[model samples]
Target: MPKSKRNKQVTLSKTKKKGREHKEAVVNTMKQAIENHNSVYVFSFENMRNLKFKEFREKLKSTSRFFLGSNKVMQVCLGRSADDEIRPGLHKVSKLLRGDAGLLCTNLPKEEVERLFNEYEEYDFARTGSSVTEKVELKEGPLEQFTHEMEPFLRKQGMPVRLNKGVVELISDFVVCEEGKPLSPEAARILRLLGIQMATFRLCLICRWSPDDFELYIEGPDDSDIESA
Candidate 1:
């Protein structure tokens, strides 16, 4: 065989092996977490923010463990069929592990989990390619938040901005973003500059699996509610 062909085959083999190892590790970690915690909860998330989620994990570190990985791997760990089920009723919970979801194994009481989830939320600037939930318009007046030095940068972001005496002012009323429209890179940047936050970091509980039974926990929010938030 040619040298190049042999090297290519070796690379492919290594990549496949690495992937299998990762899947196995995820399964093992999930199994251990389940063994250690009292119960498991499957939760969905929106507008995921890494830093904010890190803060949440820190808060729950003492009482819980979080596992976010491939849904298929999680399902495999919990077992999809009755014959090789991980636990008595975990297969039912496994079926709910779809989409942007993950496992939360905790020793805390269910009531506390519900209360914490209810109060958990983080707001941040929307990113480019994200649909704008609300209209953002800059009026033709002095922008008190920005100084004259920032006028050039704001104008570079396609805003009709100028320096007026030591303040940044909009030369005309400009629509930074429109509802339901995907935000452009410039628009997203301008929105951040204007401090118009349009993305929410939130976790939604989908179901819970206890030793005795399985229960669907929370209903998802309506589309309008998500958009208007």
Candidate 2:
């Protein structure tokens, strides 16, 4: 009932809420990354503003398994700031949570990650859909085809791009398509042709739990050697 006691109680409650289910997720992440010895998956977010935000979010959801984690929980388990330790785990999630923000952890392939990203290729819905108004920096890799097809649409947004050194850069920033114009029928068709890479491999989670300091793992046994002995 004392004032100091009451304040301490409140602080504890806040800390509990901030950490929440995050402790459980962090423990599981460490297990997967360190124990199971799975490849750490990181993502990159270029234009996640209001531009077709729902569509963009769905793209992420479909491609990777994301968990909402607390920074305190992550730091305690990671043995460092999430911004640093998590970079090796997830590229895009860390950027979104540079401060006391939410973090998404997963173990998916790089190709599938990009595949899910491009799946929303038609968010704008039309010929110009391939070309969006947002600032999209196309990095070098197998995604050049999609970027090459999107050149015209990028031009419309006043961004001229030409692949140099195997990478494409936007001369200007990308903007959301303005209000009041459904993508032309031709544009929509072009988007379909451009199509999403369509991820084939499903990200199978081997385990999910808590206790950040520890890790998880999986293994198979061979009967041949044992049987011979």
Candidate 3:
């Protein structure tokens, strides 16, 4: 009824339309990536770091390209059913494009692809809302890494701290984070300050498609096996 309400609905509608367009774009690009490259490898990744992943992409730009986006869109690009298959045997490989995975299109050999994936690992601090991989606790003692001036800020991060002479000391033992629990904003900050890296970025090849002979190879566990597990 109101102008503000109508404007809000229009914004929401635009946002939804934009998201659909993005998915369609990813599907088109993925199809192109499959068509242009010699081999297509579907790789699963966890805790992806943007900067490190970008660096890896830049390194492989000359000979390869990586496409990461919605798994459903990727599956659609590869063809979920025979009727809409992108290529002769792409539907078989598309079935393996599940979970947190992306398409890696390259002209490199299998050994080279495996080696590059292995070497491109990234370790970084976990973000807010990420599950803590390990329990972290700080004992009540002088924190030599910090100065007395940092005590106030440290206290704001839910740490019990006070200035002891010229150094910062924890007033009591604090559990910075608990394993398997979502990290809070304060917890993530404290973990960073403690130099704890809780996120590991790695990729695993789940499937491969060779265009020359139009063959599909499913690696690791296939969809049926994963469903049973």
Candidate 4:
């Protein structure tokens, strides 16, 4: 008799991966954005903050659409090569979607988009495993910022602190974080408690694509050229 197939282990190659439908939806949405908007941009970002990004998205909801997801999916949506491109020069834009990048499809003028992208920046709290950019030290003194109830919590975070006359006092100088070092879980929590924000979230435009032209900005574009595009 053949062994029962029930509860049998399956080979990895035979196991189906999920999210095909989701990737298809993303591709469809991107294609629609390309059709609906006058221009599309490839932009790179640093220290992405979801809530702040959501707020930024809300501000441009009426005139612009942003897509942030799998780079491979985005590339496929735009087509990887000129032969398969959905639009005349979109494949050029797709080639720029390398790392920490996204798409912005908009009807706004190029000048306005550039100005907004250059001016927009947000400061957010650093997370664990994020590199510290500055030294954060707490001098030996009374920490008026924290209440007596926070004493135990501070101590658990490796802070040399105690409750003194209902105020949290640092018994000795404490270095919460150091520059050029990766933040630890306790260091992140302490920095949050102290209201220190080390992460700067910003977006930079890499290139622009329109029905008529394709422009790359890394080496810089002439003012006349940008205006004409």
Candidate 5:
């Protein structure tokens, strides 16, 4: 019988790695933006909503550029030390790029940017694992908000709901979520169905850098303060 090669072993070196090209492209783009823009900013975000962010980015496309990705790649682009920084004082900005932070290069005046960031905030539905800010409870009564056909769906979501004479009814008081506790999958779904939004998707600026100087806006202990970049 001839030897069969149904399965062949492959060497580690033969495998293709991902994201190298993307990293290189990002590095090149950052360098170019630094050369063209008068200022750069480090910003952080909470409860990010991609659609809303896309809309915000589109509005500033004519005057500014935003970069959000791996912090390490951005740090590398700015360089890690004063000696190797792409620009003077850029390494300081690089150091602040930790945890859910991104870069912004723009031609807008600092005051205009600060005002825009300060006034921007959007509310969104909370997701699983998000902490509930307030208690959400439903009293025992007929649920006119939902049709009888939705009884089964509500029951599946852990609600004490039943169909009573073609209407959804609650047999007992139900607590969808409690304050200071993380939301479960069931709770999140219930809140959405109830049309209650809990998450605030906002961006906050951490620091700013220009050719002449660098400034730190977040000098307080709580860097999580909400504002725009």
Candidate 6:
């Protein structure tokens, strides 16, 4: 065989092997993300840009939750063959994810997924997607029940609500910070306090644990996760 041809065959084999390995890793991550989850909240940051994306990531950082990897990477992390409709439908969300955009795979109890991303999104960061850019649905439980808990967080987060398309809705909008950086230290205090205060005032997501559960998660949300501050 010619030297160039031999090299080409070797390169091709390596590329194919790498692709398989990447897919397997994605499948595994997806599996690990749902190992103990009650619900799997799949949200796509498809149209996110600029400070909006940074701030969105910062919010997750503050909570010690992060999502990284491209759509292809994530696809491979989650086994592509587990379910038929899921991966393709999820890919549609993943496709919207360009540049720094990503999917958040969490195991913080499926019951708490909506409350994490959408509930407090308006104030924590800007939003660019619409029902068209991204889709929303509850795979389990009553999505409506979460609305009551979510509404108050919206109020505190400084997001605007509109009767978009004849339906009352809390929609995303731009919020530019004063210096084009994250909230100031003072502001961070206020945000944490605001979230905690809102949690207390509304009793939202404030499930009372027994002594054992309390000890298990004694650190609280800010402590439990890697927070921005």
Q: Output the worst ten-in-a-row residue range by lDDT, candidate 5.
A: 220-229
TM-score of 6: 0.29
**Model 5, position 26: C-alpha lDDT score:** 88
Model 1 TM-score, all chains together:
0.84
Best by TM-score: 5
When 1 and 4 are scored with lDDT, the better candidate is 4
lDDT of 5 by residue, 69-157 (tens): 89999999998887788998888888889999899999999999999889999999999999999999999999999978889999999
Candidate 1 scores a C-alpha RMSD against the true structure in Å of 6.7
**Cα error of candidate 1 at position 163, Å:** 3.4
Stretches off by above 4 angstroms in model 6 are 1-39, 58-65, 83-101, 109-111, 120-229
Candidate 6 lDDT over 47-112, as tens digits, reads 334465566556654333344566556544433342532432332233233344344544344345
In order of TM-score, best first, we have 5, 4, 1, 3, 6, 2
lDDT of each: 0.85, 0.39, 0.80, 0.90, 0.90, 0.38
Q: Give the alpha carbon lDDT tens digit for every residue of 1-229 in model 3.
A: 5576645543445443457777777777777777788888878888988888888889889888898766777778878776788886677667777778788889898879878777767899999999888999989999999877788999899888888888999888999999999999999998888888999998777767785543333435465643332
- Those runs of model 5 whose alpha carbons end farther than 4 Å from true positions after fitting are 1-17, 220-229
Tens digit per residue, CA lDDT, model 1, 160-190: 8777778887889999889999999999888
Better of 2 and 5 by lDDT: 5
Worst 10 residues of 3 by lDDT: 212-221
TM-scores for candidates 1 onward, in order: 0.84, 0.28, 0.81, 0.84, 0.89, 0.29
Q: What does candidate 4's lDDT look like per residue over 33-94, in tens digits?
A: 88999999999999998899999999999999999988999999998777899998787887
Question: Candidate 1 — what's its lDDT?
Answer: 0.85
What is the alpha-carbon lDDT for the whole of candidate 6?
A: 0.38
